[model samples]
Target: MTWSSMLLLAVTVERVGELWFARRNTKALLSKGGREIGKEHYSLIVALHTLWLSSLWVVAWNVRVHPIWLGVFVCLQALRFWTLATLGKRWTTRIIVVPGETLVAAGPYRFIRHPNYLVVIGEIAVFPLCLGQPLHALVFSIANALVLTVRIKTENAALSGSRHV
Candidate 1:
């Protein structure tokens, strides 16, 4: 009903669409001999993200959007798009590594090892700030950092000894 609520709804819809795309990519990669790493912590990552978004919906639905923060959020989405487009079919929500497949080194990947995670970090913080929820931003950003610690380690170990980038 509110502008913030509508924006959150749009974000949720976008997330669902991304999940669908990731699932398809996961299946394809698995069929191609890719193995998923860090399965144990995957559920926690999912729950954290789900709760973050749900909390935003509960607390920010009636809040006015901040133009500056919204602009930052839009910029983060642009980075997200670049990361996704660079990875293309290799992009998924899970840590999947196919043997002999080199890590991506194009687009944002050329600059950072985990561009998608960077985008996610920005989203978790910026989205709440856009809705004028600083506490929400702080809480979720901390939680996401903890999750990313485990995730990045797992990803690093998985990609270790692989081809360049």
Candidate 2:
């Protein structure tokens, strides 16, 4: 396999694993009376991410790895992991809020309102650029930004309604 193929495979595996983890956490949270906000947008988010990853293979199959972009991706992964670890079981890909739980204010959350989104935005843009496919990056980044605008609003409304975070 080419380096891009291998890297995409790794990312695919990581994403699938995260889905499994997030599903488990979501289930647990729901069982514990957690409320899921903005269920309508969840599938679109999934579809976008799925297509983004899928396009990486189609758009970058023969492209060589760009080391600097790879470095950026690695750093984003670190922030992603830190965000996940700090949130622990509370971290679902969906906006599932556990009632009575306060906002997380440690780790990456301490510095930014939505560190995960920033990391995701970087990944969407940077990964395509890693393959020298700036067009793909631009398209997906713009779509992601649109999706995030709605997502951020929904999440903020939910949090405000619950008086949490």
| TM-scores, one per candidate | 0.97, 0.96
Global lDDT of each candidate = 0.93, 0.91
TM-score of 1: 0.97
Q: List CA RMSD, all candidates.
A: 0.9, 1.3
Please report, as a residue range, the 10-residue window in candidate 2 with the lowest summed lDDT.
156-165
- Name the TM-score of candidate 2: 0.96
lDDT tens digits, residue span 48-71, model 1: 999999988888899899999999
- Give the poorly placed runs of model 2, Cα more than 4 Å off: 161-165
Candidate 1 C-alpha error for residue 159, in Å: 0.5
- After best superposition, candidate 1 residue 85: deviation in angstroms? 0.5
